[model samples]
Target: MFEPGRLHLEHSPVQPPDVAYELIITYAPASSQDGPSMHFQVTGHIAGQPVDESFDLAADLAFNFASSIDHLARRHGLPATQVVPISLHRQYDEMFADIQHKLGRHCGDPVDARHLGKT
Candidate 1:
């Protein structure tokens, strides 16, 4: 799980000094067992202009953070790079499963039937 904190972006030659980006995440309970959805709020400055946006991801899709970031980067015309390294695919999968397990425990329910295929 990504800790809720300021994510220090890597220094890349393509990144402009005038642009600063930050991501804030929050979780909220939902009416369905497949919920307790996650919200990602991306805020930043681009060319001295403020930019902000939020995306709500259901629990089933919450593990696809890298893809979400790629889409966000594309929307902003920024470079889209793999957030998870290929070598870490196994670790990422384990971590995602752990998150699902913990969420189930905390929410007092099993994983949703619709998501059984995903696991």
Candidate 2:
């Protein structure tokens, strides 16, 4: 249940200065034992034209994000030397909290085994 946010572009010799990119993450409900999946979409404008690409991942969100950025950059013909490491800040704190709450409700939280050892 992630939402699309602002676009940011890193200035590099291989990448056009006028290009901008945005990454969007969305939740995908599945019956797999690994819990929910995530779909990462990278949309942007290159030379006044819109370019969009997406891929589904079942790994950790943070890892998926970085991989998605790299995938998009490569798909758009951007050179590896021009690729920049994207840093996702804590701006989605509230959104993440909400997602946690929802996931907790949908999928029961992990039991604290340490509590079973107590009297």
Candidate 3:
């Protein structure tokens, strides 16, 4: 559930990926803070709700998104799944974690969520 900077890609030929998509590995420089925080955020339709997040550079935040989607797909019997690259808007580590907490779920492990292949 993310769309990269619409302006950033305006001049580029490739169109953005679809929702529940994954962008190729790309990085936006940290902001001008003393040491700007690095993060991963998701904003768009996901798992029956909108999702957004930010995380430290090393936290593999992207992986979490994919895992979460995977679980949801399995649970809901979606026909397909994909990973779209993400966009950044400066640093907001606390905000990202907050959103995750509000979701009250971690898209980790799927063995139990998928029963009889029907989530």
Task: Name the runs in model 3 displaced over 4 angstroms.
Answer: 1-28, 31-37, 58-81, 85-119
Per-model TM-score versus the true fold: 0.48, 0.45, 0.25
Q: What is the lDDT of every predicted structure here? A: 0.46, 0.45, 0.31
Mind giving the per-residue lDDT tens digits that candidate 2 earns over 2-116?
Answer: 3433334434244354344443434432333444544445666433446576655442342234545666666666555544345444434533444444334333444334333
Q: Which pairs in model 1 have colliding backbones?
A: none
What TM-score does candidate 2 reach? 0.45
- Misplaced by over 4 Å in model 2 are 1-35, 46-49, 59-62, 88-119
C-alpha RMSD by candidate, in order:
6.6, 9.2, 13.6
**For candidate 1, lDDT tens digit of each residue in 1-119?**
34322222322234443233333333332434455655556565333345466665566655664566546645665544423231254444544554465345443444456654442
How well does candidate 2 score on lDDT at residue 47? 34
Write the number of the candidate with greater TM-score, choosing between 1 and 3: 1
The stretch of ten residues in a row with the least summed lDDT in candidate 1 is 4-13
Quote the RMSD, in angstroms, for model 3: 13.6
Q: Indicate which candidate wins on lDDT.
A: 1
lDDT of 1: 0.46
Which residue pairs in model 2 clash with each other? none
